[model samples]
Target: MESILATMGDQLGQMLVVLGGALAVGFAGSGSAWGIGLANEAAAGIMTEDPKKFGYALVLLALPGTQGIYGLLVAVLAMQKAGLLGGGSVALTVWQGFGICCACLPIAIAGFYSAIWQGKSSAATILMIAKRPEQIGKAVILPAMCETYAVFGLLVSILMLNGIKL
Candidate 1:
């Protein structure tokens, strides 16, 4: 039984690493898409009332997209660390695979939820913009503040991926 468990871990290591990368990309992108969709919906309502605000409203709608991009970046970095890129494969121990997966979690979790909340903030900013067009500068800042954590997550994931030795 012990031998079987060891073999299972060995066999599953590479797959787990790949799965981690996939999860990072998938969750973050999905969250961004949902958040952007929500913000866009609100923007559409505002657009109907005042078409002149399209450009301003779009700025807020686009804010959540950064998290998805960050996710993709982290996925790429994770894949590279896993040696799944550049047509070169490296054999990873089960523990290494587990490390990679663990490293991905910070960005995956942070990016997913941060984007949703950022979208909410953006939507609220959009509302503020609708009410006070002159306050557009202040409106953009509100959503941007939520982005700080996603950036930190991306940084940590990068550092963790870089630190892992195949």
Candidate 2:
């Protein structure tokens, strides 16, 4: 009975680690998709009005995609830390697994919201570019500003993961 309980506990811990990775990827990717979709719709509308501005529209639409990539990185790192990627799987205590999950939380939550807000900013930038094609540089800067918070989230996630004891 003791062995069985220990085994079950370990399994739950492993599941929590896996859940962290899934949440990191799923939430962040979903946000990026939402943001990109919004920007793309706006881009398409702009293109219909002025096909010549496709290049500008494309640039703006792509800005929010970085968050998805950041989320993916966090997920991969979490998996590696959880021993899901390397050949030797590590046996993690429940506390360790919970720590891993908490580490992933920053990126998962922040990336989701940042991507969405960035997309909105990018979509607005697209409209601005449509009006003043010459201000392309300035327009890009606005959306890029929204990317800062996503970077912060990525940094925090990395730091938290690094601080976690195996």
Candidate 3:
């Protein structure tokens, strides 16, 4: 029993290592899932309203999911930092681990809101497309505008993760 207790104490110190990596993988992926769901829902609604608008809605809904991919990149980096890749000491401090988490936060936060906005706008745009498919260009412009923020979030995450010591 004492040996087991000693092992548990040792593991306690390593918890941050697991936590930092988990944060990156879990939250980042969820952000993407949220975006996908909202966009999909909006696309479904638009498709029911106007079947011809399918292509445009599909692209718009997919755009938000790109942010999730950015999160996944950071997660992979975190695992590398934790030495799950080549088994070198990353020795990530609490502050460093926290910073990594912060790096992923923007994508998770910005992605959640922007996806909904894009989805709704896409739904509206689908109507315009149904009326005139040539107007699809203009309809896409709104979601394109929303994409700027997701891009910024991805950029920030990439920059921060680059600095993490592995």
Candidate 4:
């Protein structure tokens, strides 16, 4: 009975860790998709007005995509940390698994929100550049501002993952 219970506990821990990885990837990836879609809609409109603006519009459309990349990085790191990426698996305690899950939340939440807002910002910038193409430089900076939070979240998640002992 004792051994069976211990095994169950270990399995539960592993499940939690996997859940953490899923949350990191799922939330961030979905957010990026939505963000890209939002920006694409705006870019399509702008491009219709002047097909020459494609180059400038492409840059803005790609800005929100970085958050998804950041989320994937975090998820990969978490999986590697948990030994799930490799053939072997770590025997994590329930507390350790929960901690890992919590650690992933920073990037998961920040990436989701920042990407959506950044997309909105990018859409507005796309419209602005439609009129004054020369201002593309300054316009890029506006959407880039929203990226700062996503970067911070990624940083915190990395740091937290590093701090967690296997």
lDDT of 4 by residue, 1-166 (tens): 9999878887887777788888888888778888889999999999888999999999999999999999999988888888888659888889998888888899899999999999999999999999999999999999999999999999999999999987
The true-structure Cα RMSD of candidate 3 reads 3.3
Which regions of candidate 2 fall more than 4 Å away from where they truly are? 1-5
Q: What is the lDDT of residue 153 in candidate 3?
A: 68
TM-scores, in order shown? Answer: 0.91, 0.94, 0.73, 0.94
lDDT of 4 at 54: 99
Q: What is the lDDT of residue 151 in candidate 1?
A: 91
Worst window of 10 by summed lDDT in candidate 3: 11-20
Clashing pairs in 3: none
Q: Give the residue spans of candidate 4 off by over 4 A.
A: 1-6
Off by over 4 Å in 1: 1-11
lDDT of 2 at 71: 86
Model 1, 1-166: lDDT tens per residue?
A: 9999887877787888888888888888887997898888889988999999999999999999999999898888877877788857778887888889888877888899989999999998898889899999999999899899989989999899888887
Computed on alpha carbons, the lDDT of every model, listed in order, comes to 0.88, 0.89, 0.64, 0.90
lDDT of 2 by residue, 31-136 (tens): 8999999899889998999999999998998889988899899989988988888658888888989988888888889889989998999999899988999999
Question: Candidate 4, overall lDDT?
Answer: 0.90
